[model samples]
Target chain A: MSTNAAKNLFIYGSLLCFVVLVILTIDTMGKLDKRAPEITEEVNAGKKVWHKYDCIGCHTIFGNGSYFAPDMTKATERKPKEYLKKFLLDPRVIKADSAMPKLGLNEQEADDLIAFLDWTSKVDTNDWPPKPILASAIAGKAASAGQALFQKHDCSACHQIQGIGGAAGPDLTQVGARRPDIDWHIRHLKDPSSVVRDSAMPAFTDMNDEELKALAEFLITLK
Target chain B: MKYQSHQIALNFYTTSVLLFLVQVLVGIIAALQFIWPDFFILNFNTIRTLHINSLVVWLLMGMMGATYYVVTEESETELWSVPLGHLQFWATVIAVGAVVVGYIVMGLNPQANTEVFGTRLLNEGREYIEAPRWADILIVISVLLFLLNSFMTVMKTRKFTAVQGVLLGGLTFLALMYLPGMFYTKSMVKDQFWWWWVVHLWVEGSWELIAAALLAFMLHKLLGTDVKVLAKWMYIEVGLVLFTGILGLGHHYYWIGTPEYWLWVGGIFSSLEPIPLLLMVWDAFRTTRETRVPVQNRIGLYLTVAHAIFNFVGAGLWGVIHTLPQVNKWTHGTQITTAHGHLAFYGAYVLLIVAMIYVTVPSIRGDKEFNQSRGFQSFWWMTISMVFIVITITGAGMVQTYMERLLGLDYVTVKATYNLWFWIFRAIFGAGFLVGVLMLAADIFSIGKRPAS
Candidate 1:
C-alpha cells in the first residue's frame, strides 16, 4: 500500500514553491499580510526531526550513501505516512528489535508526517517501498482519536477518520494495527520536512499538555 | 413574559457551564500528555476522546443555552412546548453520555492500547464506531427539535434586533449543518467534509451567529450601547469570516487526501479569516478605550477583547504561518497543527465563553458593578496565562516540527529535545488556568446578592 522514502529533489524544489506563490502575488505582497505557512510546517517539522536524530548518520537518502540503515532511495514506498510518523515517535515502536534510537518526537509534530510520508511514498521511483523483500509496511490505523480528531479538528465533514463519516481521506481502517511502527510513522511524524519539504500537518503543540498527551495516546492506540 | 423559556435558558446554561468545566479538565490532561508522553491517564484513545467529545458537548450545550435564552426574548413567547424542551435536553444528555461511555470505557479498553496512544487509537478506535452511532442519533433528534422550536417561536412573533437577528441566523444554520453530518461512508475525506459543516461552520459559521447574538444582547442591556453600531460591526465581522472562513475550511483538508486544490483554497482562505477577528480586537479596544462606563461584565469585556486579540494572533497570525497549501502540504496533522489549534481555540472559543460567564453571572444578580475588583484582577491573570501558554506551546511545537521534519528524527527524540520546556510551560499554564477557574467558580456561586424570590 506504500513505498519507501524516496530521496526527493524537492528539498531544494520546495523553496521554489514559496518563491512561485510570492512571485505570483509579488505586486500585492506588501498589501497582503504575513500569516503562518502551515503546509510547509509539516515538512519542516519532519526535516527538523530528521536532522535532530542524525538520520543521515544511519541512513542514506537520495543516494548519499550510508550502511547503517536501509537506503531511503525509495523509503516513501516502504511504509505509510502513519507508519513513518509513529516510528519517529519511537523507533522501537516499529521494530522493537531495532537498534535505532527512539528520537523522542512529540505527538503534534508527528501528525505532520502523514502527508509528508504520503508524498514520499508516492515518489516516482522505479521500484516502490524499496524493499520488496521486506513485508509490506502495514497501514497505521487512524489514531483512536482519529474520529474525535476529525470532530475536534473539524475533519469529519471533509475527511472521514473512520467509517460513517466524511470523504476527504481514505478510511484509516487498520492504519494503526496494520501499519508497522518503523521508519514511516516515526520519521514523518517527527518533521515531515526532510522528505516532502512542504507538508500540511501544522504544529499540534498548540493543544495544551493534556490534549497533546491524550491525542498522542489515542493516535498511537490505533494499532 | 409570554415565553416561559426562562427555565430552558437557565437549564441549558447550567449544563453548558458544567460541561465547560469538564472540558477544562480534558484540555489540561491532553496538554500534559505532550509534555510527558508517559504521564497519568496516558491512554491516548481515552484522553483524545475526552478532549474532543467534551469540547463538542460543551460547545453545543452553550449554544443550546444561548439559543433558548435569546429565542424566548426574540419571539416573546414560550418555546412551543416545555415538554419538547425537556425531551431535547434529556436527549442531548443521553447522546453525550453514550459518546463518553464509548471513549473512556470501551474505546480505550486496554486491548486497544498499542505502542504510543495515538497509533493504537488509529488501530483500535475504528472497530468501535458502531457504538457511538447511537449517541449520534440522539444528537440529531435533539437538535432537530431545538431548531424547530427556535424557528417556530421566531416565525410566530419575530421581533428582530441586530442582536436577535444574529441569533435567528445562527439557529437557522445550526439546523442546516446537521443534515450533512448524518451520512455514512467509508471515505474519510467525505466524512470530514460533511462533519466540518457541523463543527467548523458552527464555530466559524453558525455558532458565531449565536455568539454575536448573545454578545449583542448582553452588551446592549449592560451599557445601553447602540444596537445599530454593534449590528454594523457584527455584519463586518461575519462578512470577513465567511468569505475567508469558508476557505478556512481548507485548513482541515491538507492531510486528508481530498485534492491539492483544497490545499490552496483552505490554505489561503483560512489563513485570511483571522483578519476579521484581528480587526475586531482593534475595533473593540478602539471603541472601549476612552469609555469610563463600567458594566457588570467589565471583566467579561476584557476577556472578550482578549479573545479577539488572541484569536487574531494565535489563530489568525499563527494559523497563517503554515495555513498555505504548500506549508500545509508539509505541516499538516503534526504537533505544529496542534499548536495552532490550541491558541486558536482558546482565543476564539474559550475566551468567548469566559467572557459570557463574566457578563451573564453579573446580570442575573442585577449588579452593575459585579465583583469589580476580583473580576478585573482575574481577567488580567487569565489573559497573561493565555499568552504564556500560547507562546510556550507554539515554540515547543515549532521546535518539534523542525527537528522531526527537517532532520528526520524520531518522535521520542523530539519529545526529549524540548522535554524541559514542555513540562515547565504546561505546568505553569495549567496552574494558572486552575486559579482562574477557582476565582470564576467563586464569582458565579456567590451570586453577589441575597437569594432570589
Candidate 2:
C-alpha cells in the first residue's frame, strides 16, 4: 500500500479507537459514579487518616498497594470494631509481632478509620481474597457463643483466622491441627506464658470456664 | 556530529547514563529488601520509588537527547535554540534531583507525610508518578521547552520527514499524558484510572511511536534503506499502537473499582498490542538481510534487533498472559506482574534508549572503531540475565497465586514457600543484570580510546 494510504488508515483507525475508548470510559465512569457511596464526614475523615499515614505503602486495598501486608479492603467485615480500634491504636497490643507501627491515632481517629473500613467492606470486590475455611467451620450455637467470646476477648486483634485480622499472631485457620488437645488449649489460653515461655500473647484470665470451653471448641473446629 | 547544536544532546545523554547507574543501584537495594526487610535504613517504599522514578527520568532524558539528535540530522540543520535546549536540560536535572531528595527525606519522616499541600508541593504516594506537584510543573515546562525547540527546528528547515512527525507526535502525547498524574482525586479508583493514562499510554502508546521512529532513523542511516518505505511501516505501526493501546488502558481498570466491561475490552485490545512490535522485528531483519554493504556497527544492529524481539516477548507475550480478566484475577499484583514489568521496561524503553546511544555515540564522539567485542558481551549478559529474571519471577508469581489465592493459603505461608526464588533472583539474575549495565557503561565511556584507529 502507498505510504499516504497507510498513514490515512492509521489516523482513521486511531480516531475510531479513541471514540470507542471515550464511550467505554464514560460508561465505566458513570457506573462508578453511581456506585460511589455518600461521603459522610466520618468516612472522609477516615479516608484522610488512611492517606495521612500512607496505609497503601504497606497494605493492599482492592489489590493496588504493596503486598507486604494483608488486603484491607474487607477489614470491617473481617474483624470486629473494637478489635480494629485497638489494633489501629497499637498493633502490638493484639499482635506482638505486627510490622504495622503504632500510628498514635486518637480515639476519634480510630473510630473514623473504622467507619472508612466499614465503607470499604461494602465495596463490590467480586469475591476477592476468598473467605477463609474457618468461617464455615465456626457455625451453629456453640460457634456463635465462641464467636461472642472471641470478639469480647478481642482474639482477632492478633490471630488471623482467614484473610482477615492482624498478621502479628499465627493464623488460627489450622490451630486445631497443631494443638488438638482441648485441655492444653484451655490451660494455654488462661496463661499463655505457662505453656510457652517468652510468649508475647496476653492471657485471657477474665473469661469464665463456660466461655473458655466454647472458645476452645471454636478453635478446634478451625481445621 | 553533523551540526554544532547537536552537542546539546551529549549533555542529556551523559546525565541519562549517570541516572541509569543510580537506578540500577537502587534496584539492587530494593531486591535485597525483599529477602531482608531491615537490610537498609531506607524503607522499601523509598528505594522502590527512587528506582522507578530514576528509570523514568533517565529514559525521558535519553528520549529527549535522541529526539534532538535525530531531528537535527533529519532536517539537515542546527537546533532552533541551542541555549533553550541546554536550559531545559538543566532545569530537568535539578527538578528530578530535588524530587529524589524529597522522597528520601519523606521516607525518614513518615509521620509528617501528607498528600495535600495546596499544590505548592504534593508528594503523592502513587507509584511511578510519585513526583510532587512542583516537580510535575517543572517537568511540564521542560517538556514544553523541548517540544518548542524540536518543532521550531523541523519547521525552519521545511523538511518534515515521516519519522520526525511520528516522533514529535509521540513526544507531544507524552507531555499531555503527564497532566493527568498531576491532579489529586479523593477516590482511589479515579486516581488509578488516570494513572494508567500516564503509565500505559507512554509504554504502549506514545513511547512505541518514539521507539519506532528511532528504529527507522537508525536503519535508514545504517542500511541506506528507503526512507519512504520505512515511513510507511512507521505509519502502520503507529496506527496499530494507538488503536490498541488507548483502549488497552482498560486492562488496569479491571480490579481498580472500575466497571466489569473492562474484562473484555482490556483483554481483546491488549492482546493485539504486540502486532506493531512484531512487525518492527520483521522489518528490521528483512532490511538487514537485504543490505548489500556489510554492517559496520554490529552492536548497534544487535541492540536494535534485540529491542524489537524482547519487546514482543516481554511487553507483548507476558503482558497478554495475565491481561485477560480471568487470569488477571490470579496474577494481578503478583510476581507475574513484576516479571512483566522488568522485562517490558528493559525491552521496550531501556534497550531502545541504549540502542540509540550505541548507534549515535560513534558520531557524537567522532570515533570510528566504537563497536568493541565487550559491547556484544554486555548485550548477551543483559539479555540472558533479563530472561532468567523474568522466568524466575514468573514462576514465583504463579506459585504464590496458586497457593495463596487459589488454595486459600495466607500471605505469610506463600511468602515463605517462595523464599528460594527470591534468593535466586537476587544472587544470580540481579547480579548479572547489574554487571551487564556496568559493562555497557564502560563500553560507552571508553569510546574515545580506540588504539589510535
Candidate 3:
C-alpha cells in the first residue's frame, strides 16, 4: 500500500468511527436520565456516601470498580433494606468474620448509601448480572421458597447449616432432628426470646405463618 | 546518546522503574489481602487504589520518556528545553508522591465534593484517575510542558517523519482524553460514562497509537527496515486500531446503565478489534525476516517480538473473550475481567516500556555490549508466570460464574469456598512475576557496569 493511501485509511477510518461514536454518545446521554430516573436528593447523597468511603474501591456498581467485594448493582434486591443498614453500621453484627472494615458511618449516612444503591439497582443494564443457575438446581421444592426467605432475612449471617454458614447461632444442621415439633419451630422463628430466654436471634414477626412453616420444613430436611 | 538533551529520558526512565517497583510491591500486598482478608490494617481497597494508581503513573512516565528519546532522534536535534523537561519530570514525581502519601495517611474524606470546587481535593475515589484535583492539574501542566518541548523541537526542524507525526498525534489525544475524566457528574452512570473516556479510550485507543508508532520507530532503528515500508504498515495498523477501538467503547457501555444498543455496537466492533493486533504481529515477523542485518541487542528484539505476540494474546484474544455482551453478561465483574486485565496491561504496555528501555538504555549508557542472560531470563520468567496467573484466575472466574451467577450462590460464599485454590495459585504466580521484575530491575541498572564484549 502507498504511504498516502495508508494515511488516508488511518485518518478517514478514525474520523468515521469518531463521528459515529459521538452521535451515539449524545443519544445515550439524552436517554440516560429516563433509564435511571431515581436521582433524588437522598440518592445523590447516598452516592456521595459511597464515594466518601470509596466503596467502588471494593464493591462494584454496574460492574465497574475494584473486585474486592460483591457487585452492589442489585444489592438492595438481594438483602432487606433494614438489614443492609444495620450490616453497614457494623458488618460483624451480621457475619462475624466479614472482612468489610467498619467505616464509622452515621445512621443517616447508612440510610443515604442504601438509597443510592436502591436507585442504582433499578437502572436498566440490559439484563446484566444474570441470576445464578445453581441456586435453582439445588433449591428443592420445600427449600426454594424457604431458602430464599433464609437469604432474604440473612439467616446464614448468624446460623450455620451443614457447616457452611455463620457461627453466632446454633448449628441448624441437626436442629430439625432435635426440635421436631413444627409448631415449636414456628414460635421460635416468630419470637426467639419466647422459646428460649435471652435469645439473641431477632424476632421475625414480619414473616407470615406460611413462610415460617416453609422455613421450618426446609430446616428439618437439612439433616 | 545522539543529543545531549536526550539524557533527560534517563531521569524519566529512572522514576518510572522506581514507581514500577512500588506498584509490584503493592500488588503483592493486594494479592495477599485477597487470600487472607485480615492480612493488613489498611484494607484491600486502599492498597488496591495505590496499586492501580502507581501502575498508571509509572507507565505514563515510561511512555513520556520513550517519546522524548524517539522525537529527538527523529527530528535530528536537541530537545527545545532540557531544563523544562527536568522541571516537568520532578513536578510529576512530586505530584505522584503527594498523591501516594495522601492515600496512605489521610485516607479519603466523604465530604470531599462539598469541601472542594466540585471535585475531590484529596483522593478522587474514582478508579485509575483517583488523583486529587491538584494532582490532576499538575499532570496537565506536566503533559503540556512535555508537549511544548517536543513540538518546538520538531517545528524547528520542519521535517516531519510519519513516525513523529503519529507519535505526536497519539500524545495529543492522550492528553485530551484525560480532560473528560475530570468532569464530575451527580449521576453514577454519567460519571462512569466519562470515566471510561479516560480509561477505555486510553488503553484501547490512544495508547495503541503510541505503542504502534514506538514499535515502528524501534523496528526501523534496530532492524534497518525501510522507513517508507514501516510507515505504510504503521498507518494501516493504527488506523484499524482506532477505527475498531473507538466504537469498541460500547463493550464497556453495555452494562454501565447505558442504552441497550451498546450490546450490538460493542459486541460487533470489539470482535473486529483483534484483526489489527493480528496484523501487527504478522507485520513484525515479516519485517524481521526481510532484514539482513544481525541484531546486536538480541534481548531487545526478543521483547519486541514477545510484545507483539503477547499483545495479540493478552489484549486482543483475551479482550474479545468477554467483549461480546452475551458472554460479558455472565463474566462482567468476575475474575475473568481480572485475568484479561493483568495480561493485557502487562503484555501491551508493560512489555513495550521495558522493551524501549532495553533498546535505548545501552546506547544512552555508552555500553558497547552487555550481558543478555538476565534480560532473557527475566523475559521468560515474567511471561510464563503471567500466563499461569491468567490461567488460574480464569479458572477462578469460570467457577465464580457457575456458582454466583449460574447457581445463584451468595457472592461471599463463592468467594470463601469455591475459589480458594485459584486464589492461592494466583498469589504464587504473582510472586513469581515479582521475582522476574526484580531481575529486570537488576538488568536495567547493570547496563553500564558490565564490560563490553
Candidate 4:
C-alpha cells in the first residue's frame, strides 16, 4: 500500500475505533447506571470512607487490590451484617490472628464503610468471588459430639470454621471435601507435624481416642 | 556522541538504569511477600506501588532520552534547550523520589494518623497511577516541559522525518492520555474506565508508535534500509495499533460494572491488538534479509529482534488468550493477569527501551561496542528468566483458576496450593532477572576500554 494510503487508513481506522468505543462506553454507562444500586448520601459517604482509609490497599473490591486479603466484592453476603460491622471495627477482636490491622474507624465511619461495601456487593460482577457451598447433610450424633469437642478445645482460636475464627490456620469449612481421608486428619491432629513438616498446629495428644475420632468425624461433615 | 546536546540523554539514561534497578529490587520484595507474608514489616501494597510506579517512571525517562537522541540526530541540530531537559529530568526524579519516600513513611505510620496526609503526600492507592495529587501535577509539568523541548527543536530545524513525526505525535498523545488519570471519579466503574485509558492507551496505543519509530530509525541506521519503506511500515503499524487499541480498552471493562457489550467490543478488538506486533516482527526480519549492509552492533540487532518476537508472544498472544470474556471471567485479577503483565511489559516496553539504549548509548559515548560475550550472556539470562517466570506464573494462575473459580475453593486455600510455583518464581526466575539486569548495567557502563569503530 502507498504510504499516504496507509496513513489515511490508520487515521480512518483509529476514528472508527474511537467512535465504536464511545458508543460502547455510553451503552455501558447506561447499563451500569441501571444495575448500580441507588447511591444514597450514606452510601456515598461510605465510599469516601473506603477511599479515605484506602481499603483497596489490602482488600479487593470487584477484584482490584492486592491479593493479601479476601475479595470484599461479596463481603456482605459472605458473612452476617453484624459480624461484618464488628469485624470492621476491630478485626483482631473477631479473629485474634487476622492479618487485617484495626484501621481505628469511628462508629459512623465503620457504618459508612459497611454501607459502601453493601452497595458494592450489589454490583453485577458476573457472579464472581464464587460462594463456597457448605455440606448439606447433617452430621450424625458423632459429628455433634465432634462439634462439642471443637468448641470445648477452643479450636476457633487458631482455625476458621465457616467464616468466624482466627485466620492463623486454614479454614476448615471444606476440610472434609478437601481431605476425604479421615486417617490423615486423625494423624494430623494427634501429632500435627506428621503430615506437614512445618505445621504450626499444636498437637492434641491429650485428647483420647473417642474425642479424636469425634473431632475427625465432625470435620469430615464440613464438606 | 554525534551531537553536542546528546549528552543530555546520558543523564536520563543513567537515572533510568538506576531507577530500573530500584524497580527490580522492590519487585523482588513484592514477589517474596506473596510466598512469605511476614518476610518484612513493610506492607506488600507499598512495595507493589513502588515497583509499578518506578517501572513507569524509568521507562518514560528512557523514552524521553531516546526521543531526544533520535530527534537531535535526525534533525541534524542541537536541542532547543539542554538546560530545560535537565530541569525536566531532575523534576521527574525528585517527584518520583518523593512519592516513593511518602509511601515508605505512610506505610510505617498508623493509617488513622496518615489518612488526611495520604490524599496529598502519600499515594491514592490506585494501581499503576498511584502517585499523590501533588506528584501527579509535578509529572504533568515535567511532561509538558519535555514536550516543549522536543517540539521546539523539531520546529526550529524544520526538518521532520516520518520516524520523528510519529514519535513526537505518540509522545503528545501520551501526555494527553495521562490527563484522564488525574480526575477523581466517585463511581468505581468510571474510575477504572478512565484508568485503563491511561494504562492501555499508553502501552498499546502511543508507546507502540514510539517503539516502532525507534525500531525504524535504528533499522535504517544499522541496516542501511530505505527510510521510505521503513516509514511506510511504521505508518501501517501505527494505524493498526490505534484502530484496535482504542476499542481494546474494553477488555479491561468487563466485570468492572460496565455493560455486557464490552465483552463483544473488547474481545473482538483486542484480539486484533497483536496484528501490529506480528507485522513488526515480520518487518524486522524482512528488513534484515533485504539489507545489503552487514549488521554491525550484533547485540543491538539481537535485542531488536528479541523485542519483536517476544512482543508477539507476550503482548499479542497472551493478551488475546484472556481477552475473550469467557476466558477473562476465569483469569481476571489472578496470577494469569500477572503473568501477562510481566511478559508484556518486559517484551514490549522494557526490551524496546533497552534496545534503544544499546543502539544509541555506544554512539553517544564514542564506544565501538561493549564486550559481546557479556551482552549475549545478559541477553540470554534475562530472556530465559523472563520465559520461566511467565511459564511458572501461568501455571500457577491456571491451577488457581481451576481450584478456586471452577471448584469454588477458598482463595487462601487455592493460593497456598501454589507455594511451589511462587517459590520458583522468586528464587530462580527473580534472581536470574536481577543478575541479568546487573550484567546489562555492567556492559553499558564499561567505557573507554574498547576502541572506537
Candidate 5:
C-alpha cells in the first residue's frame, strides 16, 4: 500500500474500531444492570473491603488478579455463605491446609465481603469458571441427587470419592463398606465430633434432615 | 550522544536496569514462595505485586529513555529541556522507590487502609498497576513532564518523521490509557471493565505502536534501511494492531460481567491479534536481509530479532490458545494465564527495551566497538532460560487445568501435589535468567573498557 493509504488506514481504521468499542460498551452498560443486578449498598461496601485488603492480590475475581489462590468469581456458588464467612474469619478452622493468611476481618467486613462475592456469583460471566466437565464423567454415570449435593456443598474440596477429590479429609471411596449404616452416616453428618472424637470435619449443622439423609445415602453407595 | 541533551538517557537506562534487577530478584522470591509459602518476609501477594510493579516501571522508564534519545536524533535538535528531563527522571525514581517501600511495609502489616501522610498506604489492591492513589498522581505528573519535554523537542525541528510522530503518539496514548485505571469504582464489574483500558490497552493497543516506532528506528539506525519503507510497514503494523486489539479487549470482557456478545467479539478479534505481529516478524527478517549497510551492533540485532519471534509466539500464539471462549472457559484464571503473561511481557516489551539499550548505550558511552562476548552470552542465557521457564509454567498450567478445572480437584492440592515439579523447574530456570541479567549489567557497565589489550 502507498504511504498515505497506509497512514489513512491506520488512522481511520483505529477510529472505526474505537467507535465500535464505545457503542458496544454502551450497550453492555445498558445490559449490566439486568445481568448483574445485585449491586446493593452492602455489595459496594464489600467491594471496598475487597480493595482495602488487596484480596485480588491473591484471589482472582472475573479472572483478574494474581492466580496464587482460587478464583472468587464463583465462591458464593461453591461454598455455603456461613462456611465462607467462617473461613474468611479463620481459614485454618475450616481447612487446616489452606495457604490463605487470615485477613483478620471483622464480622461486618466478612459479611460485606461475602455479600460482594454473592453478587459476583450472580453476574452473567458468560458461564466462566466453567462447570468441571470431568467431574460428572468420573462419577461414571449421570449425577445423582445425592452426588449433586456432594458437589453443591463443595465436599470434594475436603473429601475424596473415586480418586477425584481432596486429601485433607479421608478417602470416601469405600466409606459405604466401612460404615455400612445409613443412620450412622446421618448422625455423623449432623455432628462429626459427636460420632468421632476430635474429627476435623465440621458438622453439617446447616443441612436439613432431607439433605442429611440424601448425603448419607449417597455415601452408602460410594463403596 | 551527538546532541548535548542525549546524555540524559544514560541515567534513565541505569535506573531502568537497576529496576530490572529488582524485578528478577523479587521474581525469584515470589517463585520461591510458590513452593515454600513461608520462604519470604513478605507474603507471596506482596512479593508478586512488587515483582510486577517493578517490571512495569522499569519498562516505562526504559521507553522514556529510548524515546528521549530517538526524538533528539530524529529531529536533529537537542532536547527541549534537559533539566526538565532530569527532574522527570528523579521524580519517577522517587515515586517508584516510595511505592516499593510502601508495599513492603504494608506487606508486614497486611492492612489496606494504613494511612501515610493523610492518604492510604501502598497499593489500590488491583493487580499490575497497584500504585497508591498518590503514587499514581505522581506518576501522571512525571509522565506529563516527559511528554512536554519530548513534544517541545519535536516542535523545535518542525519535522515529523514516522519515528518521531509514532513514538510521541504512543507516549501520549500511554499516558491517556492510564487515566481509566486511576479512579475507584463501586462496582467490581465497572472497576475491572476500566482496568483493562489501562492493562490491556497499554500492552496490546498503545505499546504496540511504541514497539513499531522503536523497531523502525532501530532498523534504520542499524541497517541504513530506507525510512520510507520502514514507515510504511510501521503504519500497516499499527493499523492492524489497533484494528484487532481495540476490539480484542472484548476477550477480557467476556468473563467480567460483560454481555455474552463479547464471547463472539473477543474470540474473533483476538484470534486476529496475531496476524499483525506475524507480519511484523516477517517484515523484520526481510528488512534485516535487505539492509543497505552491514550491522555493527550485532548484539542489538540479535535482541531485536528475538523480540519479533518471541512476540509472535509468546504474545500472539499463547494468547490465542485461550482467547476463544471454548478454550478459555476452562483456562481462565488458571496458571495458563500466568504462563501467557510472563512470556508475553518479556517477549513484547522487555526485549524491545533491552535491545534499545544495547543499541543506544554503546553510542552514549562513545564506544565504536565494545566487547560482544558477554552480550552474546547474556542474550542466549536469558532467552533460553526464559523459553524453558515458559515451557515448564505452561506444563504446570495445563496440569492445573486438567486436575483442578477438569477433574474438580482443589486448586491448592493440584499445586502442591501435581504441579510442584513445574514450579521447581520454573525457579531453576529463573536462576539462569538472573545470571543473564547480571551478565548484561556487567557488560553494559563495562562497555567502554578496553578488552585485555
Candidate 6:
C-alpha cells in the first residue's frame, strides 16, 4: 500500500511538471504580430511625430488642443488646393495672436500627412468618439484649403477641438457627422444662424466661392 | 437587561463556529489555487466551483442555525422538533462533505490525458463529477425536512408571532423556492433563470423577512424594547421586501435571454430593495437608543454590529451595484460578481445568523450580564473583519471584471492578475471571522462556570 501510494504521487507530480513544460513551449512558439509591419510602422511613426511637434498643444483635433489656434480636425475636408498652399505661407492673416507660428513645410510631407489624416477620419468607428471623426478627417481630400480659409476668417477664436479652445464656437470633431451640407454651411458662414435662424457659424458670403466650398465641405462631413 | 431564553441562544453559537471554520479552509484553498493555477492535480475551474459552492453551504448552514434560535423562542415553545434539527444537522454535514469530495473528483478527472486548454480536459470537470442529479435532489430533500419540521411546529401551536412567522416563512422560502432548481435545464438562460429564483429570492426576498423579525425579537428580548412596535415595523418591512423582492429577481433576468423589459424592471425595483434593510438597521439603533439594558454576553452585542455591517456590505452595496442589467452585462460571470457574492453572502446572511446566535444562546442560563464586555469586543472584531472582506472582495472582483471584460484579457490571465490579492484578502478576513467565531463560542457555551461572582 505504501509503495503504491508513493508511486501514484510520483506519477501525478511528473505529469504536472510535464504539462507546464508543454504549455510554456506552445505559448512561446505561437507568438506572432499578425499585422503587416510596413503600414503599421508608417501610421505609428506619424502618430509619434504628431505627438512630438506638440501640434496638439496649439491646434485641436478630435476636440483636444489649445484654444487660441484654429482647429485642424477638418483639414482633409477641403475643396481647393490653392487655399491650403497660400495660407500655409501667411499665418498672421488668420489671427492677431494666431499663436500658430508658421511652421514651414515642403508640400510633399504636408500632402502625405494631410492624406494620412484624411484616411484616418474615414474609418468606420461605429459611434465611439475617436474612430469615426478620425476616419472622415482622413478622407476629406480637398478640405485643407478650406481649413486654411476658416483660419483666415478667424473661426479659431470661437471654436475648440480635442481640448484646445475658442470660447465662442462649437466643437467640430464629428461635425461632419453632425450637421447639414455645403450650401447651408456657406450661407451660414455668410450670416449668423440667428439672422439665418439656421446657422451659428457666421456667414462667409464675403469669401469667394472657392473658399466657401472649402469651409462648407469641411463642415458638411463633420456629422 | 431584559432576559433572553437560553435554549435558543445556545443553538446559534454552535452553528456560527462551524461556519467560520469552513470559511477559513475554503479561503486557504482558494488562495492556493491562485498562488499556483495547477495548484491541485487539476484545474482552476473546478477549484472555483468548490470555493463558491462551499461558501454557499457554510453560509446557509449558519443562517439556518440562527433562524432556529429566533423561531424556537419567539413561538414561546421549546423547539418543536429537536430530533429533526439534529437530522438536518447531519444531512447538512454529509451534503457539504459530498460537495467537497465531488469537486476533487471534478479536478482530478482533468488529469486523464489532459493538456492545458484541451476541450477533453475541460470536459472532465463536468464529467467526472457526474453526480447523479441525485446530489442536488438530496440537498432539496434536506431543506424540505427542515421546512416540514419548522412549519409543522407553527401549525401545532396554532399561533404565529411576528418572529416565528418571519423565521418560518424564511425556511419555507428556502425550501419551496428551490423548486425552480429542478426545472433548471443546462441552458445559460434557463439555469440563470431558476438559479436567481432561489438565489435572489432567498437572499433578498424571504431572507429579509427573517432578518427583520429576528432583529426585532432579539432587541425586544434583550434590550426590553416593545414587541408590538417592532412587530408593526416587521409588517411594513415584509411588505416592502416582497413589493421590491419579486421584481428584484429582474436583476438576474437582465443579462439572461429574458426580454429587455426585465432591465426596466430590475434596474428600477431591485435598486429599491435595500431601503427596507437600511431602515431596519436605523430602527434598531433608534429604538434601542432610548433604553439602556445592562447586558450579558457582550460578544452577542458585538455580533449584532457585525450583523449590520455585513448586511450592508453583502446585500446592500453588492446588490445595488450589479442590480442594473448594464452593469451586470459586464460584471456577470466575472470576478466582479464573485466579489459581490462573497461579501454579500458572508457579510449579510452569515453575519446576521451569527448575531442571532449570540443574542439567543445565553438566554438559558438566565443570566442577563454574564461576560458582557468580551462579547462587545468580539462584535467590533467581527465588524472590522467584514469590512476587510467587503473591501477586498469588491477590489478583486473589479480587477477581474476589468481584465476579462474591458481589457479583453483571457480568463487565465485575468485570474492570474488578482490571484495573489484574493488569497491575501481571504486570509485576513477568514482569520478575523474565525476569531470572532471563537469568541462567540465561549459566550454561548460559557468558558468557566461564571466565576461565582
DockQ of each: 0.02, 0.38, 0.58, 0.28, 0.66, 0.01
Question: Model 1, range A50-69, lDDT digits (tens) per residue?
Answer: 43333443343432222224
Clashes of 3: 9
Best by DockQ: 5
**What is candidate 2's fraction of native contacts?**
0.37
Q: List candidate 2 stretches off by more than 4 Å.
A: A48-54, A81-114, A129-168, A171-212, A217-223, B115-122, B448-453
The TM-score between candidate 4 and the true structure equals 0.86
> For candidate 1, lDDT tens digit of each residue in B340-388?
6667777776676666666655544454454456666666666677677
- Residue B301's lDDT within candidate 2 is 84
Our model 2 lands, by Cα RMSD against the true structure, at: 4.1
Q: Point out where model 5 deviates above 4 Å.
A: A138-154, A166-187, A192-223, B115-120, B449-453
Candidate 4 clash figure, as a count: 2
Which digits, one per residue and each the tens of the lDDT, describe model 5 over residues A13-40? 9999999998998898788878886678
> Worst lDDT window (10 residues) for model 2 chain A?
A134-143
Q: Is candidate 3 or candidate 6 better by lDDT?
A: 3
Residue-by-residue lDDT tens digits, candidate 4, A1-223: 9988987887778878778777876777667777778878788777777766566666667777655566777666545465567677877666664556676677898888788788888887666554323211221223378897887776654467664454546788899999988888899989876896545566788999988998998899898
- lDDT, candidate 5, equals 0.86
Tens-digit lDDT track of model 6 for B1-453:
121323323443465466566555555554555554344553444444554455566566656666665555555554567777777777777766765675465345423312233222222122112222456678788878766766676666667776676667666766776666554232223333555566677777767767766777777776777766777676666666666776666676543334455578778888887887676777767766766777555556555655665676577777788777666666655545556666676666666766665565545554444556656666667667766776776776687566544543333334444445765765667677668656766665673236424
In terms of lDDT, model 6 sits at 0.55
- Model 5: docking quality category: medium
lDDT of the candidates, in the order given? 0.54, 0.78, 0.84, 0.79, 0.86, 0.55
**Lowest summed lDDT over 10 consecutive residues: which window, candidate 6 chain B?**
B119-128
Off by over 4 Å in 6: A1-223, B1-16, B40-47, B110-132, B184-186, B365-369, B372-377, B397-404, B407-453
Off by over 4 Å in 3: A136-140, A143-188, A191-203, A207-214, B107-114
Q: Residues B249-328, candidate 3, lDDT per residue (tens digit)?
A: 99999888898888899999999998989998998899999999999988988888889888989999999998888789
